[model samples]
Target: MKKSSMKNRLRPLLLTAVSLTVAVAVSACGPADEGAVSAKPTAAGVEPSTGRPTTPQTSPSSSASSRTTASRSPTSARTTSTSTPTPKQAIVKNTAAPRTRAAWPRVTFARLTFEIPPGWTLTTYGSDACVQPVHRAGLPTMFDCAGIAIKSGSIAGNELRSYEARQPGGWYAATDVQPCPVRPTLADGSFNGITSGTSSPPVESGLRPVGSRKAAYDRWTAACTSGYRFSPQAWHLPVSRVLFLDYTGHAETARVLESVRFPG
Candidate 1:
């Protein structure tokens, strides 16, 4: 009976040892199984235990895209800076003094001499004469060209013409009344029947000094159908038949008239 009891106690010890062995085996396998689970692939971006999104692994294309974005940042900044506009500068006006008399140049035409502003030129077409800026084109070579006696019709200058049969009446005598001399049509250079109508009465008429001699001064306005209304001024010396005509509204006209000189 004692032997049977001792066998029962040893049986209990063996059972306990078996239980410990099984527990040891299970503990060792637990770590290996957990490591296997960790090594295995999970669905795309999600974690196995948390079921939450995990950090994405970088790929070649994604790294290239990041590099591309970084490269374009400087270009975008440069474009934005260049698009801004700059302010405009202010304009300046010209304000200077007039030129003096000694600075003027002398010009001789026909038998009379006159002083013109520097850089002025005198051109003669037969008995007719024109005084204008040096840059102006030469006058037409004809006895009576169009706009020859009107300020608006010609360039800003002076015109001098000798007495002729076809010439307008106001050329020699201030009392001689005439029609507007500017022809109606520019296509034909010849004079047409007084299409521009009669001239307005003399605005001013009297004797004016011209160098050593006195001249008959007359100023009148004339109009033409070609949309030109011009003033015709004349200084006529009856003895010399020297007619000085100024058609332009030039500021130098008064100075030019005052500078006219005649020989005794």
Candidate 2:
């Protein structure tokens, strides 16, 4: 009986030991450790439970910020440009006005005309054989039956006389035309009337006679008295239809003779 009582005491001790082992296992496997802290939920692109960071979420503001930074980069900076130039021109100037001259007077007679200095008289007479009056120094106030006159003018204080006459068969009438105290005639019977055999004294060279006529210079002497005498120089030009004659005491006579012309 003592042995049976000892056995019951040992069995109660074994049950107590088994119950303490089960409690220890339950405590170890059921819940986490009390010293460790649990993580909270996080944003997108992050470990939610662990609360560790990942790639950040792309927001509208951040995208705009990136574009702004790209625009301000060194390769995209602003710069300046160049331009072109212009040209020049030339300049001119004008200084003074032009000069003019007065018109010379025209003297016309006997189907002919010529130019003379201004304010000169030209008197025509058809009364006696178509006489044209002229005046010269140391000579009579003469008459040209078939001629014209360029009277005294202020240019030289002188007068120049010219004649043009129509004759039969190209004959020259010295008395009716420009009379000389000593007259001359050609041997060719072209001029039948005159005082003596003709002498062909040459006129100044290059003095073309009026029209197609040839030039002749006739020098003559008149004996009015010892106190009054005159030597005259006459230039004659005989053409097909008319004979031209001139008398002038001035050196400008050739210039005056060259100005003669026939009327149409």
The candidate that achieves the highest TM-score relative to the unseen native structure? 1
Residue runs of model 2 more than 4 Å from their true location after superposition: 1-102, 127-140, 143-208, 211-213, 240-252
lDDT by residue (tens digit), candidate 2, 1-264:
999999998999999999999999998889776555334323455554345554455577887898788877644444222222344565666655666655656665545565555434455333112212243233333234213223211111111223322111112223343333222233453432323212222223233465334554444433321223333344444442333333224443454466667555
Question: CA lDDT of each candidate?
Answer: 0.58, 0.41
Give model 2 RMSD, 1 decimal.
23.2
Please provide, for model 1 over 1-264, each residue's C-alpha lDDT reduced to its tens digit, 9 standing for 90 to 100: 999999998998999999999999989887557778668675467666567665555677887898899999999999999888766797776667767647578877667778877777676765567676666444321124322221111112212333432234343232323333444335565433333313334667888887766877877665545456666567766666666676535677777778877766
How big is the positional error of residue 225 in model 2, measured in Å on the Cα after superposition? Answer: 0.1
Q: How close to the true structure is residue 157 of candidate 1, measured as C-alpha lDDT?
A: 20
What TM-score, over all chains together, does every model reach? 0.42, 0.31
